[model samples]
Target: MITNEQITAYNEAAISVLNGSAKNAKSRVKVFRVSQLIAQETIMESVDGLHLPESSRETSAMILMNVCCNKVVRPIDGSCCQPPSAPALTQKLAAGFFGLSIAGCLILHLVHRHGHRRSRPCADVEAGEEKKAAPAASACPSEVVLQSCCKLGLIMAYFYLCDRADLFMKENKFYTHSSFFTPIIYILVLGVFYNENTKETKVLNREQTEEWKGWMQLVILIYHISGASTFLPVYMHIRVLVAAYLFQTGYGHFSYFWIKGDFGIHRVCQVLFRLNFLVVVLCIVMDRPYQFYYFVPLVTVWFLVIYITLALWPQITQKKANGSCFWHLGLLMKLASLLVCICFLAYSQGAFEKIFSLWPLSKCFEMNGNVYEWWFRWRLDRYVVFHGMLFAFIYLALQKRQVLSEGKGEPLLPNKMSNVLLFVSVVSFLTYSVWASSCKTKAECNELHPAVSVVQILAFILIRNIPGYARSVYSSFFAWFGKISLELFICQYHIWLAADTRGILVLIPGNPMLNITVSTFIFVCVAHEISRITNDLAQILIPKESAALWKRLACMAGFFSALLLLSSIRGEHRR
Candidate 1:
């Protein structure tokens, strides 16, 4: 019915509009294609000289595709694709890290030169006054600082490469179920390599404790690396291992205080620094929440609790308390008060949450908003540590009474008493197994943990006390591992496992065994280096002579000021 001229004009307008849209879409597609090309070229250049395996290259490409094409959904209109944005922050961080590494190298060079010049003067002075001569300084003001800086830079580089070039980043998925062969293999290896202690020692001697921790740590590492947290038995046993660590903490600190009877500022600072230095540094470098590294904070808090309880009570600090009964009563009273406090926290969830979520420390609880997280972690092994302290008290008291075997002498008790102890230990072990097997949920497990943990802890104590077992079962390998267990645990959060312990990175790709071996070797080396650095820092921070109150105040002020500055920078960067 319409005129021919009008219809032709309408058709021409429609064609022009479609042409405009097509042109825009074509330009967008061109931009995306160019960006993709550039990303591929950059990645290829980065790995060109490395001579990576074919599987590794393929994996690397897949990782890059994932990172670059992430969140780019298909358009219903079938329009142009948007290009991926570059990881600008990650690149900037890598640059800053390399710059710091260079600065550290320069500082090391200067320090070495200065040390050489000062050595002659120090030697001359020592020659003049042999009696008053100071000990020679170690080489170059502790290369620990340089080593730590370099390692940090390397870690940052790895992270940046994985993020920017998308080398090893992959979607995290639950691994398929596997047999218990891996864990069994781990146990058999540990047992086969076990070496008994040659000399006579106490039931829970330093070596034995270290060995226990070492074996537990090794098992835990396997569980994590193998992604076996889904397995209930492994998970439950890991919980027990963590509880053992807390037990050791309680026993170690209590024994030290009981023997030395000293809780000075210097001691507190030393312990805090040893536990927290690396963690704090990582928090700044990696932009992670303080609580991301929760174990250190947990131990630090426990240490504070112990210090406050002992330092406040004059009776506990008294070198020569009148009666053994009186000392025992005082100790029990303190522990009872602590138990009451813990109970109050457990019962009052709101109060507990409010306390942990308070300003400053709240930064740590950012990842998990609920106070239940903090409570669950605190309550799981709550009584286990106290059990350790109680055991230590009884052991020491028994030693004082001369009723127990002091060294390698006669049995502490008669044959009947020994038999009874053995029976009790067996019952305790069976009880723990039953309790573990019955747990239906994490909440239920946590609820029963404090009660059931006592059985296993006691069983281990009794077993260790058995004369025959004690003499023929020591593992130097475990003892060595135990010494650096803290480092291994902390360092594993980043390089060893990635994505906040959720996923594993593929370094060698196709060959799983080769990849694991390479990763583990590097991980161990890094952890050992960190251990050395921690020791060096301890020596530097904790002076033999007590620092003056004013000097200590000044140091704290400077430290907090630096931390504030770092926090501000991080906040700005985040924005």
Candidate 2:
């Protein structure tokens, strides 16, 4: 309606204002490229802080936390395999337990010392010359509980510090599987120099078994730390080491029952307590499921299976009153029955899965509501225990017939017999190694694993025991490590390794050598302490007297009932 010049001037001014606004918006946004990807982000500073509404002085912590705790939602690749992280609840519980355990240990120690000093003065006056029996440390429930808690606290602190705070962790510290042989060489060099046992080592005796367990555990630790499972030959051999452990379980338990002729439930309970007390505590502390520590579950199940097999009707024992050929035949029949059942179970993965998926067992074993992992683990080592029983049967039969003997100054027949046995073992060893290396996949390796893993186990035993001096003397260094191998196995999943054993733990951060050295020292020391606590707890839990056993069992049942109730509540909350 107005003049053309005036209208044009109005429109130009409006256009200039719009352009300035667009420029300001562009300035607020940042565009960047990383490698092949590009993204845009808006940058801004905090205008106001978070605060809890209507909080008093006592509740002021809520406000502080609200303001201080900033969360960054880092996008992780959902498809790639990674370790589970600590949850908020896990961190809180772990922190509390850490504090209580450490402080409780110190306070209890002071109280115990003070009480002992007070008792000494009275004892000097009351008993002029007679010495009173010292109180049994194992009998004290308070000390055992405190020590166990202390063990848990220390380990949790190390785990929390290393994993969450990244105290000793370094980025991009990937393990090189190609360097596997280097550790073997160094370990062998060290092994040769360790002082030998003075006692004449019997076949599979404590010293011998300990040394065997030590070297095997060492290999397993190396295998896990280096992520060498991808290397076929090494992976397959490590599988054999695992099989050997199960073999020990069968042989040791069977030998104990047959030779000692003690099939009492207390013996079984003691063994279970020793094996699982630390693991159960860890399950609670680490907030991991029982199935998370795969090895213990595997070993535990096998132990139970072996126990049931021997404890069934017609108990066979060479040391028992009914120790005759018929009883020995009964042992063979039981072993055969076990093997047949194992074969049937192994024949169908679905059937195995269905069996383990049953209500109560599923709660213990299933990961993400599936037993695929358990099935894979269970089936791979299914027949190994039977092999152990068979081996024990044959060995015991031979010993009973006086064809073989154990102890000092006794040669296992002529030196030629030993040499021939050693030569055959070497052949079997190389043959298995070659075949294992040729496998393209783990499935293929596991297919023949049940049958051929025994080859490696037997070969190692023959090679170890065939030599005259080697049979007589053992390495004390390896034996020492062997003593705590179980603890090491369970503890390594947390502090020694990281991310539930998918990564190695770093304690020094910079130099890999120094880091490994320091971490290994701390790891060994912690494991040793854990081993002591486990022993002390086991001693108290499995009492010698019948009345005390029932009392302990009642207490344990109540404890478990409470745990189950809490777990149920947690599940309901999640739902």
Candidate 3:
């Protein structure tokens, strides 16, 4: 719809600004004007027919600029000059650090090898037993370097293949016509079924919880890969799964703290180290903020909150086993207080922002200019964790009182009572599903989520464990995956998927099924390796002895201090 007169004005303005930009930066007014003009959809329709012949060099640049900027957002604050791109400077620094870490490892190996070699040589030529230690001495570094290169090469190859090669590029063509069947089909194919001996099958035991995590994680992965977020029902269900995870985080940690009552610096350090280790590495390597992997931070925050809540008062332990109504009342009061605080924070984003934006804490948690993302995330699952804690307390209390019991072949309640509960649980779950599916928009669904998420979660638990056999059996397939579920969740950000999981990594190319299979094998292997590495590191870092623990903590604190200094330097650089 833009006229020829407008086109001419645009061309002239662009040329002048482009020329002037060499000597001095173009003003926002000029850039905005140019961007605004070219963003018209009609311009593309008329692009081929345009007849204004100008200087070849400027004209070609103009044409390219127009093409790149077409349908792009209008400039605001002169940011249009910088087209969208990855966090280049940060990514480069991450890459540099990655290489440096590898180099440092090689150096350490060489030093150690050299020291060992001095004591035991291939050729004591003075002893004349052999002609050469020279080649043997050379073998360790060369062989080690080659081995290191191969490892580095494999990682670099994945980065290049995923990014530059476009073997698995972000594609929305498939998403435009996405279907509910896609995820369902994926679920059916990745069926959750496995068996184990029934000797130790308590309700919500390790295998049961692992199976829950595994299946939930798998569904989430499928939902993402298939771009099923467009479906309100699918999105709602996924949100519930995430809520369930937070619920487990609350339940599991609260149980540990209350029962073990260790409250030692060492236990806290170990848990934090386990949860944050991969996330911290990813933040540096992927040039993402800590809040970018929001789940871990959410879990970490909740864990600390639970720790403080229990650690502060007259400490109650499982060993303190006697029935104390006063202690129970105290626990309930603590939960109520936490709920109030959660509501207060969730009620006002401004208050949430103000509190988190405080200086030292702000440095760690803040993303970009504010904490709105954190606020949004925090508000979404606000009550789930508390619900988890409440559930844990109730279960533990009942168990303490000999009021409820669970075993391998025993139903949660008496037969008739179990049947009634089963019916109620199934009805509740179905009703919730129906409600979730009927919601027309994300806003409508999310508004009800924090309050009602517990319904579906509790309902699922009842349906899962009310029956003796059902409670006893869990899918070992899912449990295996659940063990590495954290790594899988974090790793999918980079290698298993691409574009931060906007698309799948096409390791086999062309054949989607084959690619998925191959990529999955690699992904699972990688997750397992990361799990092993994390456990190995934890063994060294988190010692049982209190004295050893403090030294490790001090070293970790120093490392974080340096990281904070670097971040501050970067912030100043931006200014």
Candidate 4:
């Protein structure tokens, strides 16, 4: 039996496998044969632990390796080298940019302070009406206080810009297509900007990464401030913005994990559930500002399909042998089952809508006859749904190891239940497709197809259950886009607000193409820039006096409170 000391030695050596400083560790450990290594429990456990926590796993492994190497090797050779620190220029520039961004934030904060002072109640309506008067006066900060704060002053300027644009828009009265056209153009331009910056400007030391995280937190602050101070509508209130802010942060957190490559079923579930949180919140809080009803189907269909397909996918990872017909057939059947679920969903939804017609809830979500046409109204809208599905597939692939492992050692039955499920799914999809194809007119299709919605929901459940079927094509690309999706989603309105104020696209009245093209382009670039700046800021700012995760989140809440003032002001002004 291996002594405890020997086992400890073996565990350290195993960790050294990934550690950077273990250059000579291999030579030292080579004294022991492969048989000795295979017999080590610590080594096996270390390797097993590698698949946990998507972020920091690589670093953790490195640390483990380094520790092990120290124990086994006198002077580790061929170990990973520590990266040199950033050059002075990089550091200086980072600091300079960071300071400038903070200054911007400070200015905005000060302006907000001033806005509050001005809004303070005067001695009017004292004594008897004191209670009512206090509530009214305390309702919001005053305009005078706002003007005093320089940072808020810029926000106010933006608000005025929006106001001016709104006047122009109201006069021109853009139709649906025209509305999104400008924004699309701006988004493209932003993409180009990001592409130009893709070259590695500098490598971030661990310290720098931490600093950058702080910077990111601060940038979030700016948005939160603007949300509270700026003139957005009541519907676009601070509470809603905060929820979206959580989503943005969550996405960033998830991305950190994705890049690190440590994935499992639990992590996948977290991402799915977190993303769903935003979807649910938005559904409850926001009305489709425009005919942007497309986001509903766009976001819905992909998750629905992927969830269902994956939920029932026979465990391909479990099979120790090479791939076989059973795997392929099982996957196909799983997909089919999803389709069947979708069919049932569609039928059920239709039934509900028919029964609930004129019901208060149904009225709010009355669908058009040709739901597909509604979905296809903007080609881009369809892309959102397409991308959503793609993302689900991508997540599945990333967590393939865990999913496949789960299916291992199961009895090999014909999987008759899966087959039946698949049949139902296929029929549902076909039925819905037929209905879509046979629709007489777009107007007739305007009545939202309840059956179609059901189909989507069922599909989602099926995809979620499937295993090893999802192959994501564009991880990096989509990740980048997804990172800023919140910005694109929110800034669309701001860009529109700005352009309408400026009368820039007034000539192309009712042309959504122009609106989408220009506004999207500008919105994307601006949002991307803002994102970069904020990320940088998050690195600099810390929850000083050191705290826990929940406390950190609370700090964020405080930061958001400051930002909410900006949003409330903006919303109030807009209204």
Candidate 5:
């Protein structure tokens, strides 16, 4: 055993070296001071040992160096630093804006109430004659304006809370790989609590589609939360799920255009507004790039493609007086042409980048950013939506010929043909599973995904179409989640995952399970509210009976002008 006097001597020597080094270390003075204090504590605790082990001594030295280095390397950039106090003038302007928003909301609410009261006397007189009260008009212009202001203020407040107010702010940590069984457990729990859809429905009906989207979105959420992208199987499955969403997009848009044949500006605006409203709002409030929430842009682009292709072709737009075969041929030709265009873009990465990086969109990127990154991400499953459109055309054609009929309650194929379809589906499922399992890299998987994904998508469609499969096995619970799935996907980037989607924020530190539960609950609730707001806005922006053509055109122009001005102002502020 070492004597106390020797230990004391060793401590004295350590303290002298620490002080001399600290005196010499000018750049890392703070770190040295901290390290010296820690060293003194360690020495006191280890008094029985006259001399530290070689490894322990080395470790202590490393700890000291690291402490000093961390202090010296701490970030000084404005991006990570605590924001400086706002100028008095700027603070006054912010207060004014908040005051105006609140005042506007209250005034609008009062005006509405007054108007309702004024209209009541007339309704009462009519009530005596047994006439029903006229349906209340949609939310008035002032009310809409007030609602818009309130939403803007709420978003700004939320961003403040997340970033500067310290309410939601916390240390951001890189995502760690979670347990393999996490996703499995998530799915099982979701299934256990699933609310089955009991209403009669056709194969791939609205409810069924909703259920598909809901379940896929839920699974994707789980995948993201678990940080399971490092696991190849989970990664591949998530890819397939993303492909399924695009497939639904292709099917939904094509079916709507085919049946309604109304590709008006109003329809286009409504769809785009629904898809992009939340994302655009967040972009302004959070001061992020447009491409930050990319899914909306992807869907918007595809919708344009479908709309333009159908609206431009006379043969495709003609009524069904022409033979069904002719319609099918026209559709096939269009799809083939689309495929050719996609292939050409894929052949030349430069051309693809050039197209997406043009003019207004170029402004979305900060200095020195490469367009190729965006191009690569978009192209990975580029052809999946086209596959969906092709399938939709085939399905519709079969339905027109009465080969597939929900009303008849009959199988689309004879017993022998059904067996063949079933066999094909099983084979396709196995093939995709094997292919996904065997892939070793993202590039390899992306190269093979376009073709492999179709097999599984078709398998799911076929399986769902079996007599009672769609109606009897639907999940109402998943369908509800599906309705707000887009919001969840976009919002999670900032609110659920932090640091530009690279990490998670430590909220209720040291309790991962409770943190996740609380975060997810809050995330889901916010997403639902966002969806409701978007729907309400859509109703206001795209009413059923639109104004005259000239009026509508004028309104569109005015709206775009205002949006451009607002964007320019935001850009200047960011600078």
Candidate 6:
């Protein structure tokens, strides 16, 4: 692998070329080619600095990636090209492509149209005029359409693969045979085929300044680990994913470090972080006693510190004034995804309880000190409700400050409609809280927890002012748990199967303390390692485009295998 030091030196060299190359480029292609050349030169310079065993194809592709990124075009006569004036048909098409509801799509269209006008002109005439245009402005509508269509095709192909795998897995579950390995094989095939073409794709190369590099590395590491855990079967993966997500949410508040203030993704992150804080906090408060886990509040403080540090220390938060509308659209998609998550959780909960009594609806209920729990030595529900509220209040205060700032360009208050909706949500939550307080049985309160969860869900939906999506800041584990979250949640129980303790692992072999320590270590390490290997091979061999399909199939296979394995062990023990 090329070293970082080499990359830096090459980048410095490429900068010199970029500074001097503006004089002679005629056609856009030529300019693009020049950029490509600079990128290639930089990569070559870096390659010469390090020894690697990579195939020639890989080296060439990397060089090509540099070339694609470095190219800069002079305008075609009149103005810097703005994506051909977006026709109404194109707007409609964009709406359809994004899977936005008609109303949501219309809202986006209006926002885009309004925002489009305010963008700097592609180019200015030489009558003492200066040109100012964002890089995304230069993108062609045809290119956007092509990419959208390609992504859709990929999704369809993936679903087809999944359906076949699901049917095949019904026969044998351990997944040690070729039929079970089909998806992995398919990914390896596709990765080899498409990895070469990836060089042709011109993904924006955001300048990796030191500050940006540090933050990106940290976030990406968390993302990688969290994603990897999805393939494992550890009970605590969900909780860990949640905690990491909270950390990510906290970090998102400082997005001014790289993106513009109005950047849609930045705003979406703001909303998500808020939502996550509420969920985690409320769960803490309404269910469980304060344990060492209460230190989660310290994250809120850390968030504040980072926000202040970024705002006050400009050196840490540099960004170009103009960036990409693509990023804004991306934000909208992410904001919309919260709805997808809620639906998924609801569906999964229903399916899990229906198929396996172990995951009963009551598993997610509020906890109370009771005789059964005392005898069983297990706490099914641990509430974090108060902590959630505390985090929300802090977030609200920070957001209010942002709104008050003159640089924000718009007032911070939710629109009039949003305010009315907020009022309704507050009323609903209060009424529910009052009703719940009057309840007696632990079962009754436990039953009510899901309902209360719905209220908060609705509130979050209202705040986003978008239907079927979460608007509140949510924990970052959504990204972290993208692949391996399910594995971590389920697989760790087998370690305890030997102890014949209930589904929950208790670490008392001959002695409770030693067993617990050994159990936790074994569980965490085994789960982490398993997830890491599964995800590592998948990451290397499978293109991200096919990851989702493979992940779903792999999970289904893993789940079935676990079920059969456990059943077989039980039978042997009975015999």
Residue-by-residue lDDT tens digits, candidate 6, 1-575:
55667866787777667666666555212223334344444455455644432454465564455445423431222111112222232223433543433344456558778987987575555655667565655434334334333433333232222221111111101213342234335433543343111111111011111122222233333332223222222212223324333334333454443334343323333432432322232222222221212233334434443343334422221232223445434433432343354345344545423432332222222124212322111111111222232233334334434542212122224456546777887787577556655656555554445335445434532443321122212223222333333233323223422111122233353464475466545544544444453433333323334455466447745854654454345335647
Of candidates 2 and 1, the better by lDDT: 2
Candidate 2 lDDT over residue span 310-405, tens digit each:
888877777762447777777888998998889998888889888898866876788866899888888888888888878887877777776764
Evaluated at residue 487, the lDDT of candidate 4 is 42
Q: Tens digit of lDDT per residue, candidate 3, span 268-312?
A: 888998899878866655556788788888899999988887777
The best-first sequence of candidates by lDDT reads 2, 3, 5, 1, 4, 6
Off by over 4 Å in 3: 1-168, 176-193
| Alpha-carbon local distance difference test for all models | 0.68, 0.74, 0.74, 0.38, 0.69, 0.36
| Model 6 misplaced stretches (Cα beyond 4 Å) | 1-412, 415-437, 440-452, 458-485, 496-511, 540-575
Error in Å for residue 334 of model 5: 2.1
Estimate the lDDT of model 1.
0.68
In candidate 4 the C-alpha lDDT for residue 493 amounts to: 39
RMSD to truth, every model: 11.0, 12.0, 9.2, 29.9, 7.3, 28.8
lDDT (tens digit, per residue) of candidate 1 on 104-206: 8778878868976765533346467534345766655446556656665666555444322345633243544453356657665875587865365676777
Reference-based TM-score of each model = 0.76, 0.79, 0.76, 0.31, 0.77, 0.24
Model 4 accuracy (lDDT, Cα): 0.38
Which 10 consecutive residues of model 4 have the lowest summed lDDT? 196-205
lDDT for model 2: 0.74
What stretches of model 1 exceed 4 Å from their correct place? 1-98, 101-107, 110-137, 140-165, 170-184, 198-200, 315-318, 409-412, 469-473, 548-553, 561-575
Write the number of the candidate with greater TM-score, choosing between 1 and 2: 2
TM-score of 5: 0.77
